[model samples]
Target: MHVPDGFINAPVSVAAGVVAAGAVAVSLRGARRELDEATAPLAGLVAAFIFAVQMLNFPVAAGTSGHLLGGALAAILVGPYTGVLCISVVLLMQGILFADGGLTALGVNITVMGVVTVVVAYALFRGLVKVLPRKRGSVTVASFAAALISVPAAACVFTAIYAIGGTTDVPVGKVLTAMVGVHVLIGIGEAVITMLTVGAVVAVRPDLVYGARGLAAPLKLRVGGELVDAPAARPVPVAARSPRAVWATGLVTALVLAGFVSFYASASPDGLEKVAADKGIDKNVEEHAAKDSPLADYGVKDITDARISGGLAGVIGVGVTVVAGTGIFWSVRRRRTTDAAPTHVPESV
Candidate 1:
């Protein structure tokens, strides 16, 4: 959920900002270990995809809706460190460009939606995968469960933050109950979406899925009625076309989802919005700083056609996020490569 300004007092908000900044710094370092040539570009695509899917909010209750928080999906597809960065980029873009989240509450949103969700989901996902059967299906199952839990975990974190710094007088217990209850329902939708997306990627390119790596069992052979490890197979040549094919397909899918399908998303308020209203969390909410931006509220300024305006905004968001994310990831990957390169010692002679 995107926290707006004034919901949390200045002291707590600034503290969260510091925490968020530190987390991002740590993630950047961790991501260097996670990203390589093959996966670096994919990381950017993962962010864009998450941005697109989040636009299609599905109805959770009579008046409440939910969208993909995308922690599990991104972590399963990429890696946790990169996943945190991915969601953070989306939150930043939405806050500054679309005014969907408040600038002052950026840290709160990043902490709850990016750091907490990614950390919790990835931890649970790894645990589940370790105990379950090491099959592709198991990864999907783990993904679903991880996503299901992450939403409520984020809600609990938000509740705790509110307890410390909430501007309203609402009881902390009541706020926690309502936030967790609605988010649980929202978590179901998150689980399904994560399962399907992770399953699809694992099916097409398990190598690209960071969580699925090393899950494949070694080849076995039966010799003299005893099973023994098979000889290592010869490396198969990757067609020059495969990588481009997958990238093209994924980018196209993201474009379609954001540009065409988002128009059909439920218009009702999302889980956090609904809970805030019912629990009085919005009593002190302030207007977004970017509220007057041309692309504010996911619509083009002076655009009368709701469909066209929203579609253009969505498309623009996807493009910008992809470019920004790719630039960040590619630079990280390059730096990692440079660091790993051999350094020559000269002048000893």
Candidate 2:
């Protein structure tokens, strides 16, 4: 959930912000190890896809709705480090450009929504894959479970934060119970989305899915009535899996979802916003810093038609997020190049 400004005290907010910054810094370095010529573009598309799916909020309970968190999906599609970056970028873009999330309390969003989700989901995914049968189906199953748990874990974290810094005088127990209860329903949607998306990518390009790596069972062979396992081999580099086709397909899908499909997204407040309103936590909410922006609230300023305005906003968001994500990933990739230096000369020469 995006914690708006004034929800948390200044000291806690600043502290969370610092933690978010440090997580991003660490992710950038880790991403350098994960990105390459081919998967670099995939990283950007993953961000765009997350942005798109987030627009389509599904009904979770009696008047409560939720959307894909995308941490597990992104971590499975790209690497975990890059997954964290993708969500962070989306959160940042939404806060600054769309006025969806809060700018002042961005750190809480990143910490709870970005880092915590990735860590919890990926860990659960890995744990499941290790014990389950090493098959493609197992990967998908693990993904579903991982995604299911991550949302509630994130909710717990937010509950703790609210306990420490909530502006309202509401009891912490009520907040925690309501937050966890609603988010668990939300987690079901997250799990399904994560499973389907991961299954699709793993089916076509398992090598590109970081979480699926090393999960492939060794090729078994029967030689003269004796069964034996094939020797271990490193997987093909993700760059060899063909990037242009996937990138093109992903871009088209993003365009379709944002430009046309978004018209059908649920017309209800998401889990956090609804809870805040009902629980009196939203009383102190401040106006978004970017409220005056033309593209604020996911609508074009001058576009009269609701469909057209929202469509334009979605398209623009996809384009900007993809460009921004690609640029950040490429920069991280480039930093790994070995520094040029003078060659040593032999003393005899």
TM-score for each of the candidates: 0.98, 0.94
Please, what are the lDDT tens digits per residue for candidate 1 over residues 1-349?
Answer: 8899989999999999999999999999999999977788888888999999999999989999999999888887889999989999999999999999878889999999999999999999999999998889999999999999999999999999999999999999999999999999999999999999899888988878899998988889999999999998776565642456667788899999998899999999998899899888899999889999999988889999999999999999999999999999999899888899999878775
Q: Kindly list the per-residue Cα lDDT of model 2 for residues 243-288, writing each as its tens digit.
A: 6776888898888888788888887888888889889999899989
Model 1 pairs whose backbones collide: none
Top lDDT hit: 1
Q: In model 2, which runs have C-alpha deviations exceeding 4 angstroms?
A: 231-240, 339-349
lDDT of 2 at 226: 92
TM-score winner: 1
Q: lDDT of candidate 1 vs native?
A: 0.91
Q: Give the TM-score of candidate 1.
A: 0.98
Which residue pairs collide in model 2, if any? Answer: none
lDDT, model 1, position 109: 93
Worst 10 residues of 1 by lDDT: 235-244
